[model samples]
Target chain A: NAGVTQTPKFRVLKTGQSMTLLCAQDMNHEYMYWYRQDPGMGLRLIHYSVGEGTTAKGEVPDGYNVSRLKKQNFLLGLESAAPSQTSVYFCASSYLTPSGGRQVEQFFGPGTRLTVL
Target chain B: GIQVEQSPPDLILQEGANSTLRCNFSDSVNNLQWFHQNPWGQLINLFYIPSGTKQNGRLSATTVATERYSLLYISSSQTTDSGVYFCAVGDYNQGGKLIFGQGTELSVKP
Candidate 1:
């Protein structure tokens, strides 16, 4: 399985610019998430989707929006980028059903490095 | 919001040495996972141990859910183990919303 994959491994954008990050998973996971990683901040969830056609705000969802139109795809959108949004973005997916364990482990992507000027 | 904290923000060890990393959470959690972010920036899930102990190769993890903490042990480490190790927790009340810790940076020298 390809697991989880993210597009635009690296990007550079100026203030007020807009961009969308694409995440796709072949594992047929029921849950998908978007997270941002910054130095000394770990990985903070930006948004998540429980399933297709469903999305919810996460801990840090102010400047970001998400859409999950299909079961295999999740998109993160930054309408107006800001310098503070310059961080490594990660996409993760997990299955809700128990698989040998009660806790579901999330599989992460390679991460997208975004730099805002 | 539940808070997660990892100890020993930085670690340096010889390739053959052993090390222990810790993660402490502010509240009770029903799920906890350990991950290794390689130099290439790939977050690889190491263990999904919310409680009890589990061993994989030269690595092992133990989580005491009642105490709200977890430990990861690396034995006979190798240069390939150089990376950041993070622990994330999800409260049972929450719908599997995992919160991450700052992570412990490990540098194994050959």
Candidate 2:
């Protein structure tokens, strides 16, 4: 399995520009998430989906929107880029362990580095 | 909302040295995890220890759920171990959402 994969490994945008990040997972996970990592800090969730066609806001959901139109794909959109939005973005997927451990161990993608100037 | 704090916040170690990183949460959590973020910015799961103890090779972790704390032990550390370690905790009640600590930056020198 390819696990989780993120498109546009790196991107640069001018303030007010817009873009979308695509995340795909082959593990058939029921949950997917978008998170951002800033310098000197840990990752923070921007949005998440409990299942296909369902999306919810997370800790840092402002300035971003998300959609899960398909079971294998989740998309994050930036309506208008801002310098404060420049950070390393990561996508993760997880599912309830079949072993009944109830563990939600997340798998992450390679990450996309975005720079908003 | 739950809060997580990790310490000592930063550490420098000589290769082959042993160190312990700590995580303290403000509330009880059913899910706790330890992650290592490499210098290249990849987050790798070290342990899914919400309670008791679990060990993988030179890395081990223990979470005392009753005390609302967890500890990560890295024995005989290597240069490859240089990076940030993060502790995340959450409960099923919160949609499996994780609250992360500030992270402990570890630098292992050869």
TM-score of each: 0.95, 0.97
Tens digit per residue, CA lDDT, model 2, A1-117: 999999999999999999999999999998888999999998899999988999999999999999999999999999999999999999988887787446487788999999999
| lDDT per residue (tens digit) for residues B1-110 in model 2 | 88999999999999999999999999989989999999899899899888999999999999999999999999999999999999999775566777889999999999
Q: Candidate 2: how large is its RMSD?
A: 1.3
Q: Show the lowest summed lDDT stretch of 10 residues, model 2 chain A.
A: A96-105
Candidate 1 per-residue lDDT over residues A1-117, each given as its tens digit = 888999999999999999999999999888889999997668999998888999989999999989999999999999999999999999998876665234277889999999999
Chain B vs. true chain B: TM-score per candidate:
0.97, 0.98
Candidate 1 structure quality by residue, lDDT tens digits, B19-104:
99999999988889999999888899999998999999999999999898999999999999999999999853454779999999
Candidate 2: clashing residue pairs, number: 0
